[model samples]
Target chain A: MPASKIDLSPHNARAYLEPGPIVLISSRHGDETNIMTLGWHVVLEFSPSLVGCMISGGNHSFRLVRQSRECVINLPTVDMIDTVVRIGNSSGRSVDKFADNALTAEPALRVEAPLIGECYANFECRLFDDAMVDRYNFFIFEIVKAHRARRPKHPQTIHYTGDGDFMVAGKIVSRRGLFRPGMLGNGRS
Target chain B: MPASKIDLSPHNARAYLEPGPIVLISSRHGDETNIMTLGWHVVLEFSPSLVGCMISGGNHSFRLVRQSRECVINLPTVDMIDTVVRIGNSSGRSVDKFADNALTAEPALRVEAPLIGECYANFECRLFDDAMVDRYNFFIFEIVKAHRARRPKHPQTIHYTGDGDFMVAGKIVSRRGLFRPGMLGNGRS
Candidate 1:
């Protein structure tokens, strides 16, 4: 099922939807810290490890990120989908997200934002730039430090397919020896 | 398999490596057109759909995109991995990508760029803003028009894992009736 062609209406056009695991981004400003679910993000570069994420201007976390300029991107596995959805539905602006979600905060190495102990990997990031914030509501970041389970703790990560559905990442298939170098070999984070 | 933690070396920390399908971007300027595989991209908004992607200045397509300020983001499936990798490996400045790879070119709706016939979906995008392109090498685009197969012809699209490996999207599981109004359904493109 590779080359068949069919025209799709604009209303139904789903191009590259969500691809990566949903992340729990923790932000801090002053004495308050907030946690929220983030699915709109992408890796922007390799060497400096840049990432671009979209945070609605209305979200409470956006304000915190603006003030603190730091956050932790925590990757949740498939087992955490239900909790992820719950977090996504709830607002971090009103409640103590950590207590409401029963999540733990572990200190990060380089950023003030704490890591989500429950997730598989945590990237302690510092805001790299925010030039597009006004027009696109996007934030550019650099992973100042990162952590992961030695062996995948929950390798079965889930990607949201709008309408409260998901697609679990399965089986590893490499195009062995096809790499052209410059790629980080053991992508630890 | 959830609580174990390992400190990943910063050099190997690839926190959010592959979260979406790798796309082949088709760009044209004047009489020159080029195809380049892109993985560093993410969705930035829902309505008036916005996308953020990073294209290094070294790539030939970047020149075309800079001149045209328009492109088609084509989503390739698992079956097109080889071709995708090949296109990624070769430079568009010297070679005729379409002839070498045997990819088809179809007219687009809102943009001057042509769609890749083998791709599962094509988003006709226009460069909305390029202010951050200098410092971050990021391009903010808005999907002005889109098209997709009525159904996911290759439901199993591939995500590029660093170092020539990839992860295939597998198994659909949705949370029925959980979506609030306004979420895109059966995302066609």
Candidate 2:
């Protein structure tokens, strides 16, 4: 199938703005594998770590996460908006979405989940046994490994709005605080 | 007090690009009250209904969420990005951030937590239980009331990419498969 077209104009920007994280949640149930878009996810902890996401009971990916207790949280940039939307809209119940969308999938080093090649970052997570999954459709996972893509001079990403709209990463319009060495915070500046 | 400045650009966009929902968390401890930024949050379930957020144990806001078992989740759109960033960087620990930042705070109808003006949406939540929070620093909340700012022509929202970079809301790039009405598959397109 031809890749879905994406428009990043400011006028149609909301499609990308709603709870904006686009994660490729990959899992395997038995021998079958699938990937889905998840915006209802977050980092839960930093030490000995934990991460969590909300998955509706209706999704096939939810079942896979439940059964496997593992998944790869693949963070995609705006460049992968079309692919993210494609996988999100189609249910893996019947469609072989990976093959359908032509998304390149690679094995995760620490988890059974697969990672999408086009994404900017990948987090390999193992399910943290928690009680909220049923009470709130949320699952907490522990990050085992993380990878950042080759730095881009202007690496923009996509955010999800309520509807089909999406938002492309934008510029840093302003700045505050210090950037000099010997200052309190130090890293990339 | 003047708000502290943060050069969000240093994180090279990773600051705003974190794969999580940006939620405004509010709490009151004794005579002191505070609000802070939370992007490490998610909705966990629907049956008993619950919400989840990852908070640093050391922050004042975390103590509020912990002591009260009650908190609020305020969702803001792209328009509120400036306020969000301002509140995210400034702490209510020392100063009245609301007054300093020109932020308006009002009592939530359902919960004691305060609702922030200028945000597009809000979710009033109470802690679901203590089982997971103690182990993972994850707080799952039960939503009591949910509201949105007057509907926008296109309700695109701001998404953080990490550090100080954010993604701009975009348009409905395209769609596929069966026609739906809301948000890609839910129907609206």
Chain B TM-score of all predictions, in order?
A: 0.84, 0.77
Q: By summed lDDT, which 10 consecutive residues of candidate 2 chain A come out lowest?
A: A1-10
lDDT of 1: 0.70
TM-score to true structure, per model: 0.85, 0.74
Q: Model 1 chain A, poorest ten-residue lDDT window?
A: A7-16
Q: Model 2 Cα displacement at B123 (Å)?
A: 3.0
Candidate 1 residues A6-42, lDDT tens each? 2222111111122466688899999889888777787
Q: lDDT at B175 for candidate 1?
A: 62
lDDT tens readout by residue for model 2, A80-176: 7777877776789999877998877776777777777666666677887657677667786777766555466335665554445555555543323
- The DockQ for candidate 2, computed on C-alphas, is 0.24
Candidate 2 Cα RMSD (Å):
9.0
